[model samples]
Target: MYLQHPDDPEKGEVSESDSIIRTYQTYNKPYELQPEDIISLRIASLTPAEFDFVKQYEEQLGIIRKLNQYNQGTQDGGNQNNMRMQGMGAVGEEGSGLMPIMLDRQQTGFTIDRKGNLELPEIGEVQLSGLSIREAEELIKSKLINYFETPVVRIQLLSFHFTVLGEVNNEGRYTSFDPETNVIDAITLAENLTDFADRSRLKVVRFSGSEAQVYYVNTLREDLVSQKGFYLQPNDLIVVPALRARQSRRYLLPATTNIIGVTASALSLILIILNQTQ
Candidate 1:
């Protein structure tokens, strides 16, 4: 996240740590936070429960990597490897543009069509409206197998993503195939919250078929990953509320009220004195 140092009058770009140090210096009026001051920021400091949730995705990612390597002809020499190669060759002439089926990319909230089908070049209209990218690939490949021997189809989610807004540095939409991304990822993609962001008042808006649901997430105390309630779905919208300055408003309110009251009292006194004199 980008931030400005309180010491630096120019307000140039600075890291989150630097900004926090400057804030400490400004408030405490003690030792100025220097670059040499020791500091560290890493996920290693997270609680065990938090680490478990984060590592769950890591293990899943590893398994997905293995599966991809196996599917992409990366196995070492063995019976299983040879059989896989033979099966691939059984499809048709190798690299004839017939074996590899390329599917059209889809964006977030993209529906197949009115008929709930996708039109491929040779295959024509095939059902794939509500299926995910992986599911769509499997269905397409299964159908192609009837015509070809072993069809290898490549599929990708082109527009599977949502937008994050409000008190964030970079507010925009980001794409991802993994459906596990939660509110934290959404905020992280927006470069985290600004210094004046209210962590306790973050809001998430999700649009369904004919309605939208709104949720409030407290970033300071909430468990982002565990709370599936705040997890982002396709086309979800996140908004971080700006921090309301307590002193500025609270102090000004009573002072302004007193001033107005005093002014009215003075005006009444002046009117009374003028009437008596007349």
Candidate 2:
């Protein structure tokens, strides 16, 4: 149980040593923007912090921006109840709740329509689906050129989330704000695994369009950092199976207790009969 993660890698050599090596590797494929994905899109102009350009565009473009959809929402119930919409503004200084609310990763923010189009205040609808975060940012910045000389745009993906099940303390869908979420970070989010969790046989199931890939990992090894499953993607499912002994005990302990109880009852009845006879 205490092995793997050798101090050195040599031909035909192995050692059992815990390592604290920190090797950060980027994901092979970045998550592309998906339709119906929720993202916090912030647009700010340098020097003058105001949305005066929006009013001008309304008259010039003859388009109406239903900005009330951004301002007039009492955080809905469920997971979004705790997320507060503060300092909200289309574009302004501090305390101005402009476009994009940091309300939460799952509930609040701009939702891309099913057509892969994101509707903005001035730029109307821009196709953001199938584009990476950096690509989307540059596209949005280009669209803002007609409005301001220099527009600073920030797009934070809030729809990145994963699921944890089996042996974890809290088994549910968890939101990860960081783009590079590791398996260890996910375990911590689930409040760590249960006592019966098998540290050596952790399973990571990753799903693509119509295919699912599974990976088995040992949480105790230092080589975990170099594993392909180290960086978790959206919709990844992590399952920490229980040890064999733990699974056996689940069935064995209750049966053993029942046998002991029956034996005690039989002994009590025998003693009562002997006392009556005496």
Candidate 3:
């Protein structure tokens, strides 16, 4: 039921102008890292001794994560086996009693601690929170100069996720590698908005520090493309509300149809009974 606007304007209608020009320019803007943000840091051109020193810690972390996953799997399997031996119970009883285990096995990325600092292999702890991606890369590069000759430092943000809810065809959370993801791009990921979606009252909720900001968008307007809320940030949520007419059709129409069906059936039964009795 999702509808896409026409790519070309029809005859006698005004052409759709570009939305990018009206919206706040986001070109060349880098996203600032925050606490709990995961980032991938790669260091190259290290001497053999330096490589050995860093490799040791990396291997240790990898081995520890593998062991943890193995232990968790073994424990879960043992519990399931015990339940099976005690007469397998109901169909979903075993799984119902067991809690789902979520494991964070990201070995390559560095997680920013609550203190907004990350402790590297040899570079030690560096304050990274509130710094843009480019700034973080330069800061880490400067720190590496003390150890390696012309060290190549590459930094990338690993967590860029957003959510789309309400009257979308497929409402769910999605991940994007592109930092300049727009509102249209996010909606496209969810298979676009449903026909019943209220084009005049779309909402984008964004969090900045401790404050939550909401931006209202009108998709039907020609200037929607130029709105500041068009460009979505990490953890931003886009909600498309349903039209009032669509809501009535969804809830009331079905009940009305059911009532009409039951009344007609009862009337037919009564007529048949009268004919038989007469």
Q: Which has the greatest TM-score?
A: 3
Over 4 Å off, model 2: 1-4, 8-28, 52-108, 259-278
Sort every candidate by lDDT, greatest first. Answer: 2, 3, 1
What lDDT tens digits, residue by residue, belong to model 1 across residues 124-227?
A: 77766556546666777776665544545555443446888888899997876544567777777788787878877678887766899887777664243334
On residues 87-182, what C-alpha lDDT tens digit does candidate 2 reach at each position? 554454465534343333344467799999988776789999999888999999899888776877778888887999999899999888887888
Cα displacement (Å) at residue 110, model 1: 9.6
TM-score list, all predictions: 0.47, 0.68, 0.69
Whole-model lDDT per candidate: 0.55, 0.75, 0.75
Order candidates by TM-score, high to low. 3, 2, 1
Across residues 1-278, which tens digit of lDDT does each residue of candidate 3 receive?
12224453466775567654333333334688899987767767646654644446655766675566556666666334212222334676664343333333244466899999988777789999989987888898898787777877777777788999999899998878677788879888999888889988889999998988999877776556667787788899999999999999999999999999999999999999999999
Off by over 4 Å in 1: 1-111, 246-278
For model 1, what is the error of residue 26's alpha carbon versus the real structure, in angstroms, after optimal superposition? 41
Give lDDT for model 3: 0.75
Please tell me which model should have the higher TM-score, number 1 or number 3.
Answer: 3
